[model samples]
Target chain A: EPEVTQTPSHQVTQMGQEVILRCVPISNHLYFYWYRQILGQKVEFLVSFYNNEISEKSEIFDDQFSVERPDGSNFTLKIRSTKLEDSAMYFCASKFNTNTGELFFGEGSRLTVL
Target chain B: AQRVTQPEKLLSVFKGAPVELKCNYSYSGSPELFWYVQYSRQRLQLLLRHISRESIKGFTADLNKGETSFHLKKPFAQEEDSAMYYCALSGQGLTGGGNKLTFGTGTQLKVEL
Candidate 1:
């Protein structure tokens, strides 16, 4: 079975530094998303991308965050000036269609900000 | 605002016992509900969706619109069922914004021997 793949399984960064998490979604998937989960917290939606543009975003996805489908297979999330609170597990997910509403998630990338 | 609530943080049951993972959501419009599971050291994956109305791994969840719940139920649970389960909701339709999932805090199910 094809699955979404994410890079940098674990990343440690200093405060005020920049970090970029990459993901390669399933080849045929049309919709992609980025979500994060703080330790012991629920998974929170950050942003969704389709057609090479952002479709929607949550308050957590503020000016510090940006997502790009730099290529046909690569989707990335960049956080500028990371803060201590930004430490969390970021997940990349993709969906084949709207009818099923089933999403395939990648093994999250753990980001640690000191 | 769409929110998913899984009241139980941890649930333990013996093998062969029945299991129920409670899930509730708050949404004004029609919502698409799903149950995702993550086994030990495994990536989060979809377990079932309300639209399918079909059971997977002998687990079934009925979407109770009246109570805004989609609780997962499984009779005679096996030890392999031990995992973390999350209930999620989506507010998007066929022609609207992207498919953004709002997930619950998740329930850790431990099927003991």
Candidate 2:
């Protein structure tokens, strides 16, 4: 079966530095999302993307966070000036559309900020 | 606001024993609930959804609107059932903008032989 693929399974970066997490969603998926899980905490939705624009974002997804498809096959989440609080496992999910509501998630990108 | 709650963080059972992972949600409007499972070293995957009213791997969950709960149950547990299970809820509002899901803290099931 085709699964969502995430690049750089693990990322280590310094505080105040920037990091980019990339994901290639299922080829035919039209809606994408980014979620973050702080260690020992429930996963929180960051943002949702559709039609090349952001549809909705949580307060946690502030100026520091941005997502872009950049191309047909790649979806990337960029964190500018990361803080220790940004250290978490980021998961990328995609679905054919919101109505079906079946989300396919990637293996996850573990971001560590020192 | 929508919220999902899983009362237990860890549940252990011996093989052949029955297993239940409790999940409760709070939402005023109509809600959709789903169960997702993730085995060690594997990506998260959907287990079942309440809307389908189907059983997968002998596991089933019933949505009780009166109780605001959707608990997953299996008559017999297997060692392979050991995994992290998360309960999620989505408010499928008009236009699908409420497509985002609220997930529980997750329950780790340890099935021993």
Interface RMSD of each: 2.1, 2.1
Per-residue CA lDDT of candidate 2, range A1-114, in tens? 989999889999999999999999999998889998999999898988888888888899999999999989999999999999999999999988787568999999999999
**What TM-score does each of the candidates earn?**
0.97, 0.97
Q: Candidate 2: what is its chain A TM-score? A: 0.98
Judged by lDDT, which candidate is best?
1
Looking at candidate 1, what TM-score does chain B attain? 0.96
Deviation from native of the Cα of residue A40 in model 1, angstroms: 0.7
- Compose the digit string of candidate 1's lDDT tens values, residues A37-114: 999998998988888788889899999999999879999999999999999999999988755657999999999999
Q: Which portions of model 1 show Cα errors greater than 4 Å?
A: B93-96
DockQ of each: 0.67, 0.61
- Residue pairs that clash (backbone atoms under 3 angstroms), model 1: none
User: Could you tell me the lDDT of residue A100 within candidate 2?
Assistant: 53
lDDT, candidate 1, residue A97?
Answer: 77
